[model samples]
Target chain A: MSRLALPRWSLIAALSLLTLAAAVGSLLYGAVDLSVARLIAAASGEGDRVASVILFDLRLPRTILALAVGAMLGLAGAALQGYLRNPLAEPSVLGTSNAAALGGVAAIYFGLAELHPIMLPLLATGGALLSLALLFILSGKAESPLTLILAGIAVGTLAIAGTSLALNLSPNPFAAMEIMTWLLGSLENRSFDHVRIALPCIAIGTAMLLWNGRALDALTLGEDAAQALGTDLRRTRLRLLIGTAIGVGGAVAVSGAIGFVGLIVPHLIRPLTDRSPSAILLPSAIGGAALLTLADLGVRIIPTTNELKLGVVTAFLGVPIFLLHLMRERRIW
Target chain B: MVNIVLDHVGVTLGRRAVVHDVSAAFAPGTLTGIVGPNGAGKSTLARAMLALVPANGAVRIDGTDVTAMPRADLARRIAYVPQGQTLHWPLTVERLVGLGRLPHLAPMSRISDTDSAAIERAMERADVLELRDRIATELSGGERARVLFARALAVEAPALIADEPLASLDPGHQIDVMDMLRAEAAGGGLVVAVLHDLTLAARYCDRLLLIDDGRIVADGTPAEVLTADRLRIVYGIDAAVETGGEWPTITLFGRAP
Candidate 1:
């Protein structure tokens, strides 16, 4: 009813436009270079069959994957940040993204990648859940936020070790390629099959993550304070665990591994939403889609001898920027 | 009726005994100052009372043994403000204060008008109403201190326990905070806090529990527990007790060279 107070409506509109532009850009620009007019015409059944084939067969799936992957990474990242109450934290730092990478890599190494495509997401999700559980147990002696992060780092290292062990034993040369793919992250050649597998898990996870907003807000004070306020600490933590596992697990499952989108998207958008966890979440979903699609577009245009992985570009872009921000904003840490 | 009792309570954290054999009775509707030096197990004692620690004995809140009470019930009974809390992120003071309503709020239910009123009233009492829209992180030390108290106030518990509530505040805010705490006790809520400023505690607290080496060395009215000789033994600081006006104040004069 009132537009003067917070940036709620403007942010929503900005996010909507950004999401739309990115979605359209995802469908049109690439090596095949179908113009915006052509892609739209094809989708609306006015363009030729060849244009329709390019739009539907290749661009459409990739665009959808971009949106799904972005939303997953962004929401997952936002969850980690909100859960830990640390701006610097994300799925990668907490081990979810890396562990998911290891799970997907193991899936490829065993040559069982296709046999149960579901297995890959499950394994990745398992890795995330297991690490989160270990973090809780091991960090019991430690105090509030620090304990969780320290435990996450330790458990993530363990998951990475397991991933390494899997790769060491695989006889498939494709396993090596898969490792590179997982390391770099990709949305290239993704099909309806890939989208189908990832979207549901990501959707379920995002919903769960969004549901955690109220609890996360409660947690900003302190655990005991949050509990005193009637926040069911154990139950809230459980939901966060499941949601993080599903969303990060699913995104990692399809992309292999991506870096920084989770951290960057949330940090950039959090202030814009007046720091309301729920409001920030949806914007993060939309912003993440835009960022990833733009990155994916950049990877396509570079024309390098060797194909660039989305993970590499994301890390290359994400790390230094995060560090600079961290240096400035780490006044409390 | 809101009195709390600790009977032979002991807490060991990470293989070290932080609090040992703490047995005492806290008077209802009175501000009881828990005074001790650094690492004197003040926080440990508060945690034990909340049943946050696996202690050796019983902590009874309003006559119900904390061990037998549901954690939710216990949450409803006591509101605890821990020490040196660093809440990162730009949380609105109102939102942060509203978190105190968590115990009273049902799961998945919307905040009722009563909850809204409670939060507003709590904010006013804690003097954080103008800070409602401000970020918690951006508030001054004095403002932040009160907002935290507002959060505790929002809990609407019969007993409120704070660990060194005024330790970080400037002298003026320290006095203001101490007055607010005394008001809570006067309002029939049991209030307990660990204090470092002997003068402030002596002037404000109705009773004092002097602790040393994880045990209560002295427990009585401020004048009784805060004698010069006991202050030397408990805090290892030389002091002379003075009587100016009706309040007996502690003046620490270092032994002659």
Candidate 2:
């Protein structure tokens, strides 16, 4: 690596190591103290039954769930930031995540959540695709930054209002109670089932999104220039829309509407850009994963009778950092 | 072969007719300058030539109508350097210039050695090689203009069209850019520019198309078209001409008869 690339590689390496250490800590130091030795013994098939149950059944899934969800959020968020060229543009901005949440809530209310294991996720994915299509249609031919933002805001508001109406008309306590989690967002009791449902979608979305980094780099100049450089504007936009829908749709299908992971992570990692879009993308994802994982970890450490919502933690962390960025942007402007 | 031909072109943005019934030709290996007073449709005419705006008539490049040609294929033949484009992102000059190679690069092709060499040559020609690694946002206005020009040059297009590129530069740099455009035409590539300075137009351009009130008032060689009468009629100025060495530099006295 050149002198310039060394810092980023080391930063990624250091963060990856920290993430692994934290995952182990998360497994070991949760509501009950469970040692890694016990975890290993459980894995090796010889340990105390209760300890094995705690380590293998409860803590392992929860800890691993956090890592997977964190990575998904980070990857999805980074892609949105890169494509929109706006640090503030998150997956939720497009309304896809909110729509997915509405779909999940609707599925649960219809009593189909137990009938078909993946019904919520499937319906949620459909909702996400619908919202994405709505956004693109509203955006029209002018995919300029201001227009895209306006379209996103319009679609997101509609989705939220629709979600509210759906929850308000339903009298079921479970359906009504789901509204709070869907809006505020959470990852409590997220199990291996959740992991299995979301992973393939996230992986496919990540590959599609990461492939467009060069096109995004070309777009930093402007759409006209990118077109001149052989980046078909319509094609690139389609890729972004599909990938964002799948990745974010998958995460929100399981976790409900998580927000701000995409909004804050890429901004934090922009200084390491090295003026290359591809170089910035993976680091941006790493930063996103680390930020979300740590934020989730914070939710765990905070004292509460019930677990704090993960979205609440992100908003608390993200809003203040966003203000700092706004102040900095104001200075620049 | 037709390098670039505008057929009865007109452009009306919203409600105002900016360019009306104006037609022109930019043959290959020739320097053409679009010159007129402010609001004389120089830019609108140029936009029609590149099919950037929806106009009544057609813009044909090498006998193929630009409207009918694939946008990418058209982009390969013609490179455009827009004037007064502010850089909102802090990109390196090399990175900015390297984008010009995008037209020729296949989907799977990384930046090849050929692309690098072309970019290097364009930077050197534009005298921005030393500042390759410098952030474009930090450059002086003239430097940025050249960097953008170098980016278009790196496209290796058969024709280049620049819009009022001389408006922001000092006298020396303005002449330098004009001379570069002249050299580009001399090297068998067509160059079309909207120039503000009448004296530079007289000296550097092979042909001049002067416009007034959305109409082509005059078009020909420097001596046949840029007469004192037409200058006063179009510009409402008392024009004076002085011969220095080999070039006749026309000076606009003022906005007075």
Q: What is the per-candidate TM-score for chain B?
A: 0.95, 0.94
- Clashing residue pairs in candidate 2 (N, C-alpha, C atoms within 3 angstroms): none
Off by over 4 Å in 1: A1-10, A28-57, A114-143, A158-178, A276-279, A297-308, A323-333, B67-73, B109-112, B242-245, B255-257
Q: lDDT of model 2 at residue B222?
A: 71
Candidate 2: TM-score?
A: 0.85
Predicted candidate 2 versus true structure: per-residue lDDT over A99-193, tens digit per residue: 78777877776767769768877888778888888888899877676787788788778878877787888777777786666667766666677
Docking class of 2: acceptable
In candidate 1 the C-alpha lDDT for residue A195 amounts to 81
lDDT of each: 0.80, 0.77
| lDDT by residue for model 1 (A1-333), tens | 111234677887888798888888778888778876887789899998989988888888888888888987887778778878777778766677777777777667776667976676666666666666666688765446676677778878887787777767767767776766666788887777778878888888888888877778767777766665556666776677677777787788777788889988987787676675655777888889888988888898889987788988888878776676767678533
